[model samples]
Target: MSPNGIISISILALQLWHCAADLCNWTGSGFGADGDSRTVLQVRLRCTEGSVRWVYPGQALRVVLEPNLSYAQRTTVCIKPSRTFRGASVYIERAGELELLMTDGGRPEQVFCFRADGPQRPAIYLQASPQSDVSRPMVGFRYELLGNRSAAPNLGHSGLQTSCRPCNDTELLMAICNSDFVVRGYIKNVSHDPERQSSLVEVSGGRVYWQRSGVFEQEEGTVGASRSVSSWHGHIHTLLQCHVKPGGGEFLFTGSEHFGEAWLGCAPRYKDFLSVYQTARAARRNSCDFPLD
Candidate 1:
């Protein structure tokens, strides 16, 4: 049982399962041929051998992730779950601290937090437990990090800092690193797709004309539960708190896609966000990577 009165399941018997496939580690920056740097790396934990099959009451699965933190100022750890992990709650044990950062009893797609002030690269302990009865065992999990924040100097693009709310570096980095297409553009237009009509997006580099729905699709038969669509679909999302005016100003946008069309949404409020995208773009150029699809 944890100090917080949560009964977590410890590793009864543990073995690194398929270290090559599961351990998807990468450096946020400072990529070298030798690969021995204090960059953040991703790791996976699986219950190859465990104490229980069905997650009973008062039992949870806990896996600790410890990365080399010698060269980094701080680290941000994010856990992405596979489809098998159902009815699970995420708990993050802060490095060098006993207090835990957990979801508000909700099933989150991903759990991420920053270890800004730790004595060392403390082991980021990630634990997940079932919230439902007779749930399936947690087979494994994956983690990723932006490893070289400290070594990389501030690129004079610390986000548009206004009195209202400051831009979060972690959020911007997550969107930038995970996105397929990052663009510098403007919001072409805003309209309601009552009949789900296609909208045209005018960007600086290029133009995107496609049919997309901005409305949140609810489950079938849950009519009227759907959310009203927004005009910011192909432009940029406001989460990054960008200084965006309708059909005005050039902004750095990060993009993802579905069904062979570009979905421009997440935007980083830094001038140098383009540089970050360029870095990722250069790496992907050789592979002929999938662009915004």
Candidate 2:
């Protein structure tokens, strides 16, 4: 034990023979016959994105992220705790030191990110808290390893300050090309959650050009004169401070999706996007070809 009475458990070097075949997710229980409260379970994941589900968490679990990335590449690790997360305090282990990331019993609605490209790779450590009841809450989180820090969405605290900034022409061009989902839509509604410090923007998409995930779904609705029209509907999350309001005319929504949830990025007026696209196309400067509506 250290002078502070906190036990410093080192990550075990044992082989991970029980790794899941998917190599991106791991699901297991912490209850073992050994009954050693100090036992630390080791899990290794080698994917850009994945998840971990720990049922009946015990002493601790160390998740080592060894994604297939080059040594010279700078990667950022972002983890979104499950909404039902409980009974465990999460930490980031860096160079034998533990830094608390999330406390037990707290609902983590926001995603946490950190740089994990140093010589000593960072790992996630989950330590179970003492329990008095018979409740066996499951604790887990989904993780994503982002290689391009500049292109990645601003999810960290520092990035929150600039979350409301309007995207410039160059940023908008790149956002449309690299974002997970791109669509032409208008804001149907904006709901704010003060507790989570976020706002969900409900969008009625007229056209979906591309999407890396199933974030938007087609919905049939009646227009004027009982005419039925099909439109894509989805929700995009953003910082509450963005002050997003409804009825902003048609916009090109482009953003990334994390853990099955969409986050807002560069959103420009559809007409403005057309002007920019046309100008870029004339100059042969557009990053990718986008079908014009």
Candidate 3:
């Protein structure tokens, strides 16, 4: 069911089984979901097998297991909204060990836990109550299980547990040219955004090398919203968490003024191609206008 108390119109079932191609290892094979609304709910798995799948609202599912197999298998799943749309987050109100009645014969399966641990490993959690003023509350589940090492020895990983990805070169260039100012600075403060969907970070002790709108103090820092955690000032220079990429952590950054407010974007490092961005800056300065060169 969705957190808003809307009942799901259908359910989905995913089954794990022993694969003859690989011994002592379980393979995820079966998947079934009801309904046609692919936009309602989304699913993504890490270190496990499954493409991003959309689900119906308030959905339920029955999970079947092989009785003789050992209970050790590594699996992590993230249920959230489709990334193609505007930024949104899932709010889980309840989760943990669950007993399910199998559909094959309506037999009950033993409870298992899929909770993730450690900062590197993100797990879904149930808040006592809903957060205030969040626009993108989704119905999703997150779990991380480290199966018995001897049984499931080959759990490989590909993508990050979180949704953030590095920015491309064109995005970096566009961000540099369109901002009020671009600075290289360290993060001095960290707080939650007003909406509670992301973190607000302030950067200080950096120099603003470029400005388009007007004059600004070199000491004055700017803030950005991010979805990832930022390192403390001086310890690690990182991007201010902001809307362009909801989660903020250590990454190359470029800040621009939007609607008279400071906004930043995750960008590629200018140092990587020092001559390129430097040349672009010089061209802009000479012409007193934005130059593609």
Candidate 4:
């Protein structure tokens, strides 16, 4: 075989090696000859959540998400770029066409989400920008795949707009029953992050009925006369557009957890929730039995 033929065969073997490895977290470097700059490395990740890092990126990389999902259900994919992410642009490939998802110079704190429904399985493509120095920039992002049962409604765009609209009676009832955590709390503080376009709501939970994840924990310190020693404290994340405010009244906080972070869902004032719950209960329309304090 010619020397050039042998070099081509070697590159083909390297590409195949990367494609065959199913990993949850992938870290690789793209540094090679001029011909290798045109090579597109393929990576397959089968996990529901993971991260990908490309160091000194030169050639393009294609990431295929093949999480185990039910055919009858829909799936949502969300990616959060690392704060230090640089030197690459991300695109979603559907039907052999590319749709730009994140620009190389875009806000790193911002998250992007899209629906991965339909017959065509979506894949992420990372195209590296031209380099001028030997700075060795790293491009990376974390990803999560949410199924229909776990995904919040309308988790498109930034995935933070799910709580923009107030939930209706039926949705409210269902949220308390299906959410990861149900708490009776008051907003202690509300902080907005413009960079991420999100709001962080600090909650002082008086009562935690149930919590799938240990997101809310008991506060340590002297308890006030009106406060319970068993009171839990936690933060709930929501989009800044929701404009969450710290009010005086207690509320029934119900929400789901994503990637270990608690997200706000349907929250109604305690009194209003009681009125709704009682009315639904009397009419035999409540989704599930919720203990009242």
Residue pairs in collision within model 1: 9-60, 40-147
Q: How much does candidate 1 score in TM-score?
A: 0.39
Those runs of model 4 whose alpha carbons end farther than 4 Å from true positions after fitting are: 1-22, 32-35, 69-74, 149-153, 223-228
Error of 1 at 91 (Å): 2.6
The TM-scores, one per candidate, come to: 0.39, 0.84, 0.27, 0.85
Per-residue lDDT tens digits of candidate 3, residues 179-287? Answer: 4455555455656644323444565544455654443443323456644432222221122233332333333445433222343444444354344456656666321
lDDT (Cα, tens digit) per residue for candidate 1, span 1-293: 46673433232232221112222231121122134322222333322211111122122333444444343533544444434544334455443343344433333333234443455443333333434544444433345433433212121112112122333444455554455455555556543322222233444433222223332112223336675432223333222233334545556655543223343445444345545545656666322232342
| lDDT of every model, 2 decimals | 0.37, 0.78, 0.32, 0.77
> Alpha-carbon error at 109 in model 3, in Å?
48
Tens digits of per-residue lDDT for model 2 on 1-293? 24542344454432222334357899988786377665677888878888999999877788988777562364677888888999899887766677777779766656888777568666898888888875779998998876663335765623232368889888988888788888898899999999888899999958999888898999998989889989899999888888888876899998877778888888999999999989999999998898994
Candidate 2: stretches off by over 4 Å: 1-22, 69-74, 119-121, 149-151, 157-162, 222-228
| Per-residue lDDT of model 4, residues 62-133, tens digit only | 888877655325367888888998899887766545677777888876778888877776688787888888
Scored by Cα lDDT, where does model 2 land? 0.78
Ten contiguous residues with the weakest lDDT in model 1: 151-160
lDDT of 3 at 94: 25
For candidate 3, the per-residue lDDT at 202 reads 60
Query: Cα deviation in Å at residue 195, candidate 4?
Result: 2.3
TM-score result, candidate 2:
0.84
Model 4 clash tally? 0
- Candidate 1's displacement at residue 282, Å, is 28
Question: Lowest-lDDT window of 10 residues in candidate 2?
Answer: 12-21
